[model samples]
Target: MEMNILIERLQALMAKGGRQILGIAGPPGSAKSTIARGLAESMGRAAVVVPMDGFHLANDELVRLGRRDRKGAPDTFDIAGYRALLDRLREGGPEVVYAPRFDRETETAVAGAIPVGPDVRLVITEGNYLLLDTPGWADIRSRLDEAWFLDLGAEARQARLVARRVRHGDTADAAAEWVRTVDEPNARLIAPSADRADVVIRLDA
Candidate 1:
């Protein structure tokens, strides 16, 4: 879908009044963040982007759980914390609600990074597991007023994943290996959840 169409749809959803949380979900490399930011930017003060990435477990915690290598897996995130934030956002309390943000350069979640004012009516949250039907994730779909899944061709998605890794400092060979060994499995896990989305935005087309 075009960006303007997406903005219009989101505007209609917000038109219903009360706080609305819009979820954008997809596999790794689908550029959900880009879409979410675009929508939020277009809406200006009316919308804020709160990514699920901020719930990523700290590196030390991941090591303790022996999930360091599988850092992007669903279990590697603070599911309960993310759910709580969404619940609060939907509930619309606190004069100003703060949300964490993931810093790619530092590879850590920075607390209180994004603030949602009381006047803001729309929250655009993008993530890999918002529509997952599995335990610890199923509730996420219900928390959002609308959820969108971003779709891209396999080859295009894989290429973007590889390029992202390289840009983040990984060598080309290592990036490809990580994509094959880590991201591909996660992508498989995320793919089926697409059916649960209210809308599927095809990025490859």
Candidate 2:
């Protein structure tokens, strides 16, 4: 979708008053973060981007759970904590709401990273499982005022995933292998959730 059009749509949604939570869900490498950040930038202080990756389990915890190899899978996150935060964000309050952020370089979640104020009219939270309908994930959809699913061709998505892995220190071959073994399965799981989104956005490279 054109960025200008999306901005206008979100602006219209914000015009209704009260706090609005906008969710952008997609498979890895679908530019969820990029789009969410762009929207927040366009809206300025009126909006804040709170990413779901911040709910990722610590690497040590993942290893203990034997889920290190599939870190981005559904069960690898703190779903309860994510849900609680969403509840609080939806409720709105007088004080600043601090949200965690995931650092790709460290592959760790830094607590109290992003601050969302009560005055903020829009909260853009993007991630892989926003529209997922499993036990823990099902609660997220209702919290969003509007849910958007980003759709990208598998070839382009996989290429971007591989490039991202390489940029994060994996060798080219290792990156490709990881994308095939880990990301592809997750992508398959995420694709169906697009049906739950209010709108599906076809994205270009």
lDDT per residue for candidate 1 within 74-159, as digits (tens), equals 89999999999998887786668899999987889999999999888889999999999989999899998899999988788889
In candidate 1, residue 65 scores what lDDT?
A: 93
Which pairs clash in the backbone of model 2?
none
Considering every candidate listed, which one attains the maximal TM-score?
2
Give per-residue CA lDDT, model 2, range 168-203, as digits (tens).
899999999999998889999999999999999998
Task: Give TM per candidate.
Answer: 0.96, 0.97
lDDT (C-alpha) at residue 174 in model 1:
97
Prediction RMSDs, each to the true structure: 1.2, 1.0
